[model samples]
Every structure is written in structure tokens, then in C-alpha cells.
Target: MTEVQTLEAPSARRPSASKAPRTTKSTANLGEGFAARVLSVLSEHQRIALRLRHGEGLSPEQVAARMKLPQGVTDRLLADAERTLQAARRAFVEALVENAASRD
Candidate 1:
């Protein structure tokens, strides 16, 4: 007879302290700075979408109803805002890297 083995799911297992993710002061600061920059550069529609979804903790359907826009349009607006923020973050990080390189 052949021996049978079973494997546990990853989520069912507990991670060791050393394997846990760490959030340092610098990492937190970087996240805050990135968010601030993204907000500053967002278009009016993007700003509204972010504010409704995050600031007020509203669902996308609720945001659409509040904005009096179609659900599809609201979804597009949210997606666009996310894309814009990601692009801004990339640019901000690149600028920081370039500045550091220049100083070296």
C-alpha cells in the first residue's frame, strides 16, 4: 500500500513573528507623503470619487447615487482615480531616487 500525505492550507497556518510584515516609521511616512501628493494632483472627478469612497467610507453604489451618476460611470471614475494615484506615486518615487542619485 502507498502512504498518503495531506498538506495544510497556508491561511490555516500561523506565520512566525519573524515572517510577519513590519511597518517602520519611514515606511509609514512614505505612504502618507505619497497619499498627499496623489490628492494634490487629482482631477476634480478623481478627488470627488476618492473622497466619497475613502473619506466617507461609502460603497461604490452609494457614491453613484450620491453623485447622481450611473453606476458604470462611477466605477470608471474610481478606476481612473486609482490609476492616476498610482502614476503619481511612481513619479514621486522616481523623483526621490533621482534626487538621491544627484546628491551622491
Candidate 2:
């Protein structure tokens, strides 16, 4: 006598497809005009590189690819942008101190 065997398919439903990827904004409660000042201190390339690196949270390699620039060039652009913003921040702080003192 031959024995009969049966196979059962799984009954559980698969999970739904994930939603589209969402890009995150760089600033969260940044001071008014602060981002503008940071961008203003940088050249066009520097600004774009900085945003891609920090704002979009991309790796240096990714930033370079997106900008169509060599990785070394993108690195230099980010460094330059950082230095410029640092100087601007120092100057802005000094000006704010002076303004506050004059009001007293």
C-alpha cells in the first residue's frame, strides 16, 4: 500500500511595502538668519558641499558623487566652509555682546 502525503502552504500575509524615503531638513529650531549667515560665508560650491555632507547626512564619497566632484575636492570644500562659518560665528558673538552692553 502507498501512503498519501500532503504539503501545506503558509497562511500568513506578508507585510506591506515601506513608504518612500523622506529627506530630513538640516535645521531644527535654528536661530533666525543663522543658516543664511552660514551659507553666505561660503562660496557656491562650498555651500552645496556643506549642505550635502551635513544636512543630508551623506558620506564624503556620496557627497562627492552627488556634486560630480572628486572626493578630495569635496573634502576641501567642506573644510573651507567650516572655517568660514567659525569666523562668522565669532564675529557675530562679539557684535551681540557689544550691542547688549550699549543697551545697558
Candidate 3:
């Protein structure tokens, strides 16, 4: 007699599909206004970067060392933060446009 090996599907380890779909949709919506909110929320990091680059007059490499982040990673994070802020601003503008269009 041979014993059969049972394999679990990947889906079994994940959340229920029914909930995941809705969560994904909400995440997309959150991403729409996420940048601006993130900027407002993480103002301290921005301040640190500003201080390092302007106030202390440190280069990105120096800033990365001081911040204890990898130089390339720090650069990417800063750029992403800026882009996220821009995305949030764009989302806000788009919302205002939709609201105005609805009024008309």
C-alpha cells in the first residue's frame, strides 16, 4: 500500500477571494490620494532630507549615511515620496473636477 501525499493550493494560504477583490479595489482608491496624505503624514522625513541637503549641505551619499539608509535606496525613497505627493495632489484635483462636473 502506498501513502498519498497531499498538496495544498497556494490559494488556501491566502485570504478569501471574495474579500480580496474588494480590498484590492479599495487599495487602488487609497493609492489615488495616498501620495499627498503620505507627504503630510511623513513630513518629518521630508524635513530631514531638506535639512540634510540644504541646511547641513550634505550630499545624497552623506545624507544616506547619516540617515542610516543605503545611498541608492535613500535617493529612491525621496524620489518616490515626491512622486507620491504629486499623485495625491493630482488625485485631489481630479476629485474636485468630478465634484464640479457633478454639480453642473
Best by TM-score: 2
Candidate 1 weakest ten by summed lDDT? 1-10
Q: What is the alpha-carbon RMSD of candidate 1 to the true structure?
A: 12.0
Residue pairs clashing in model 2 are: none
- Candidate 1, lDDT over the whole model: 0.75
TM-score of 1: 0.60
lDDT of 1 at 13: 73
Collision count of model 3: 1
TM-score of each: 0.60, 0.62, 0.43
What would the per-residue lDDT of candidate 2 be over residues 2-98, giving only the tens digit for each residue? 1113456688555555643222352223323665766765788987887787778789999999999999999999888777777766776576667
Alpha-carbon runs more than 4 Å astray in model 3: 1-36, 40-47, 50-59
Candidate 1 residue lDDT tens string, 1-104: 11113579867976798975466787679867777766777777778877888778889999999999999999998898877766776787687668657966
Q: On TM-score, who's better, 1 or 2?
A: 2
| Clash count, one per candidate | 0, 0, 1
C-alpha lDDT score of every prediction, in listed order: 0.75, 0.69, 0.62
